[model samples]
Structure formats: structure tokens, C-alpha cells
Target: MKGRESGMPEEDYWQSFFDADGVVETLFDAAGVAGDLVEFGCGYGTFTLPAARCTRGVVTALDIEPLMVARVRQKAEAQALHNVRAEIRDFVSQGTGLVSATQSHAMIFNLLHLEQPLALLREAHRTLHCGGTVAVMHWRSDVPTPRGPSLDIRPRPEQCQAWLYAVGFTDIRQVDVQAFSPYHFALLATR
Candidate 1:
């Protein structure tokens, strides 16, 4: 963490992320956590904190960047959320294995636009129990943002659904919410 900057400008984008058309409502609906829930890119704990508040199990907020990890930790601490935790983890790990019996739900917003999401999705796949849920959403249309990565890698609803299907997730489909204008699709896949 030596050369790490104080904070990321990405945190500012979250100010509007929860305000997006139907995003916040969908997040609220994502309530009702049964067991351990994992958020892949839990930026600043916007969704993580709420999901934790709604659930009873541990919330593992994993991000690749150390700065992002620190940011989420700060947010969790500021809110006095005792069950949430954050860690720095690359999408791909060389070798390791451990999974618990408890089920876990997952949320991925504006995160599927990465250059390689499958590798991380595979890790997620390994960590979930049967009947676990995964929610993935990306920008509906490409909007230029210097602060964020290129969204050219985004997947359509159908594509996301198919990807989930290919990854062994059952009940894979899109959640039709009013939050999206042209409508950004969020694919829900059950483990």
C-alpha cells in the first residue's frame, strides 16, 4: 500500500449510482439475505452496507485494488456495520481452495464491463452454495467516462444470461426493473 493514493475518484460516481433510475429500488429488493453474501467489486460499500444491513451473514467485499479495499473498509466502519469485511483480491488466483456450507448471494453492478469478468465469475462460482443468487448490471449504453474504464466490454441481458447458464448457474435470466432508461439489464443467476 506504499504508493497508494488517498482515495479514488470512482467513489464520486457512486453518489449517482444509487440514484440511477431503478438501481436503488433493485438494491432494496435485493434485501433478505439468508447467509454469507459476497459482492465482487464492493466500491465504497454503497450496496454492501445495505445488503449487510438487510442480511444476517458475513458480507465479503473483494476488490482488486488496495485503494478500493480501503475505501470500502472506511465506509463500513463509518456506518458501524460490524458484519461487513473488505479485502484485496485479484480476479485470478494461482492456486487455493476452500468453501463453506453456508449459501451466499452476489451483486455485480457496473462491474461486468471489465476486460475479463469470467475469471472472477469462476471464482465466485466456486464460493457459492446451491440456490445462491448473482445479480449483474452494466451501463445500458456506452457513455464516455474518463474516470471509469471503457465500457465496450459490456454484455447484453441475453449475453449475461447465457454466460451464467454456461457457468452452471440455474434459473438464469434478466430482472426487468424500471430503473434503466433504454433499460440496463441485470442478469440474475442462481447457484
Candidate 2:
């Protein structure tokens, strides 16, 4: 299941919507994440390359689109980031293709509005090692975002929290990420 339409913009235009480093710093720092990271959707390598550089562990970046996966791989190679492994995968339907309890952290940025958010969250939970963190960011439903799924389908902070809880994540809390991007909100949960 591909989930609802992402309403994503073109590559260059969508890349402009974020200051990749700033967003990555805020989310990763807030989560106190370390070690290997698994990203559910590596669109344009917006967060993947930066994350690979920031951590001592590998970044397994998965995307449903081959173009997106190839883009991430190109960025990683251009940046000389040997730790990033970009894969073309239908993670939404088939899961991350990573072993359970093998990753130290997971990044689910800008992807929580899927039709089966719980399925993805559970997959994240299963992949993460005990005590590992999952950092989630999504378009803020309260505000009119420049580019995101419509408010009708976007998951609010509260709704995201509930879904996280249902997936057996603990210590779930919202992070203040206004400085990173006004259009998005972040949550950190532990497995």
C-alpha cells in the first residue's frame, strides 16, 4: 500500500522547502539518537546524507520510488558518504527489509500521513533495538503548509501520538521544531 498521495513537489522545489541540515539537527538532537539509522522515505536524500554524516553508524535509506532511491545513492556517493545504503523498496507494503532489533534509530520524517500509519510505525518499532528511538516529523495540520497532503488527510500531532502509543512505543513526546520549519512538527518515541 502506497498510502495516500504525498502531494510532494518536484525534486528541486521540494528540496527548497527544507533546510536539510537544520531539520535533521533538530529532530536527531531532540531524540538523542545515535548509531545506525533507518529512514522510511529518502526523498531526494534531504535528510539521508546529513544523517549519514552525523552518525557513526550506517543510514539505510529506503524509498518506494526507484528515482528517489537512485537520487539518494547519488548524493551519498557525491558526498563520499560510504555509510549510506539506499534501496528501492515498497517499504509501505513490504516493510523496511531490515532485520528486527538491528537498528539503533529510525527516521520517519514527512511520512506519517500514510493510509496505514500504524503498519509503518510497527515496522519501525520492530527494526529498532530495545531503547532505540524513532524520530517522526510530518506536516503540521494546524497550519496551511506550502506542500503536503491536504489538511483533510494530514495527521495532527495528537493523532500521531495516539498511533505511536498503539504501536507500543514508549516515552513518546512532541519536540519543539519551529526553528527548523514552521510547516512541520516532530515527535520522538522509543521502542
Candidate 3:
């Protein structure tokens, strides 16, 4: 199924909003993101390529848009990031198509505003190995941002925390991402 539109900006404009490398580095370090990682909505591979570099195991990047998936794959190949596996998949409805308890970490950036966030969080919980972590990032609703979904639809950190708890995630804590992604907030939960 096609996911709800996120009001994603143009590629270059979207890219300008983030320091992908710094955000990835800070979040991964805090979450101890290692081993195989699963990224939801790998738009432009902004985080995917950097994530692949951080882990020895594969980075499985799934997106509903074929163009986004293709772009990610192209970038991965150009960077010779052999560990990246970019594929077009409706992960929200079909799940990640990964073996249970196989992934060490999961990335769900700028996506919780979707209609069924708990479903996606459940899938992330299902894919993670015991003690594995899931990182969630969303545009800050408190401040006006250059781009992002409408503030009315954006989920707050507290709301996201509740959803994570509902999906059987533990050790939920906020990670400060202001230095790298000033317009966003992040949370890390363990499964």
C-alpha cells in the first residue's frame, strides 16, 4: 500500500535541512547502532550511506517510492557501500520482510505522522534482536521549520514515547539531536 504523503520537500532542499553525517554519527553513537540496520523511508540515502559506513553488517533500506529506492541504491553503489541493500517496499503494511530478531537497530526518521504509527513501531520492535535499539526522529513542532509535514500532524516526543511503549519497546529516552538537526528531536528505545 502507498503510505500517506509526508509533504517531503525536493531532494536538494530536503538535504539542506540536515547534516546527515553528523546526525547519523551522534544518533548511532548514542544508540550503539551496530550490526545490521533497517531504515524506514530511506529518502535519498541521506542517512543510509552514513549508516552503512558505521556498521559492518548490512543496512537494509526500505522505501515505498521506487524513485527513492533507486536513488539510494545508485548512491550506495557509487560510494561502494556493498553492505547497503536498498529496496522498494511498503513496509508499513507488509512489514520489513526480515527475519525476526535479526536486526541490531532500526531508523524511523521523519515518519511517525503516518496514520498508523504503532503498526510501524511494532514492526521495528519485531525486527530487532533482544536489546536492539530503534531511533526515532521527527521535525520539531515547537519551532517553525523550513520544511516538514504540517505541525498539526506531527507527533510530539511524548506521543512517540507512548507509541514505542505500546509496541513493547523499553529503555525509551530522548536523544538530543539539536546540534546536528536543529529542527528535529530524537528518541531511542530498546527491544
Candidate 4:
């Protein structure tokens, strides 16, 4: 199923809001994002290519939109990034088709405002091995952002942490991503 509308801006406009490579480096370095990684909503391959460069293992990038999946695939091919696997799938409704406990890290960036936040977290939990990390990022509600979901639906950092904890994630700590994405807050949790 499609997720709740995030008020996503046009691709270029949305892309302008983040320094994708820098944000990826910061979050991945802190979370030890190695081995195979799974990215939820790999829109425009913004983070997928950067992540592929970081890990030796495959980067499984899933998105519900076929255009997004195709875009990621094209970019990966153009860059000769043989490690990326871009697929069109509704990961929110159907869990990621990865073997349980097989992923080293999962990226749930800017997607927590969905209808079932816990369900998504649980899926991430189910797919990750023990000690595997999940990185969560979302727009900060306190600040007026250029783009994001409605303020009422936007989750606070504490709420995201609580959901992570509820799904059995540990070592949950906020990471400073303001340098790259000043409008967003990031959290890293271990499964």
C-alpha cells in the first residue's frame, strides 16, 4: 500500500534540501553501515549511490514507485555500481523480501510518518541480524521546513525513539545530522 502523503516536493526541490553524500557518510559511519544494506524509499537514488560506494556488500534499494526503482537502476548502471539492487515493491505492506537477520543495516529515512510506524519498524527489526543497525531520519517538526508532511502528522524524535524501542531496538541514540540536513533529525538503533 502507498504510504501517507509526505508532501514531498518536486525531485529537484526535494534534492536541494539534503547533501545526500554527506548525510549518508555521517549516518553510515556512526551506525557502522557495512555488509548488505536495505534502503526504504530509495527516491531518485539520492542515498542509494552514496551508500553503494560505502559498503562492499549489496545495497538493496526498494521503493513503491517503479519510476524511482528505474531511476536508481539507471544511475547505478551509469556509475558501474554493480552492488546496487533496485526493486519496485510496497515494502510497507509487504515486508522486504530479504532473509531474516541477513541485513547489516536498514535505512528508513523520512518515512516514519506512515500510517503504521511500528509495523515498519517491526519489519526492519525482523530483517536485521542481532546488533545490526537501523537508521531513522525525519523532518524536524519544531522548525519550519521547506518541505515535509503536515506538522500534526510529523513525529518528534522522542516518538521515533519510543517506536524503535518498542520494536526491540537497542542502542538507540540521536545522531547529529544538522550539518548536512538541518531540517531533519536522525536516530540510529541496533536490532
Measured over all alpha carbons after superposition, the RMSD of each candidate to the real structure, in angstroms, is 4.5, 1.2, 0.9, 1.0
Q: Report the candidate with higher lDDT, 1 versus 2.
A: 2
Estimate candidate 3's alpha-carbon lDDT, on a 0 to 1 scale.
0.90
- In the range 1-191, model 1's lDDT, one tens digit per residue, is 11122133555654554444255346436533477777776666667777777666888887677877897788778888888878776544531132643446777766765655675566667777776777786656444433333344556666677777777888776666544323355667778
lDDT of each: 0.63, 0.86, 0.90, 0.91
> Candidate 1, which ten residues in sequence have the lowest lDDT sum?
1-10
- Tell me the tens digit of each residue's lDDT in model 4 across 1-191: 88888435577988899999999999988988779989988888888999999889999999999888998999999999999999999987788989999999999888899899999999999999998999999999998988888888899999999999998999999999999999999999998
Candidate 2 C-alpha error for residue 19, in Å:
1.6
Clashing residue pairs found in predicted model 1:
22-179, 131-191
Candidate 1 vs candidate 3: the TM-score winner is 3
lDDT of 3 by residue, 9-50 (tens): 678988888898899999889988779989998888888998
Q: Pick the candidate with the highest lDDT.
A: 4
Per-residue lDDT of model 2, residues 48-72, tens digit only: 9889878989999988888888888
Give each model's clash number. 2, 0, 0, 0
The TM-score of predicted model 4 comes to 0.97
Model 3 lDDT-worst window of ten: 1-10
TM-score of each: 0.78, 0.96, 0.97, 0.97
Q: Deviation in angstroms for 83 in model 2? A: 0.5
TM-score of 1: 0.78
Residue pairs in candidate 2 whose N, alpha carbon or C atoms collide under 3 angstroms: none
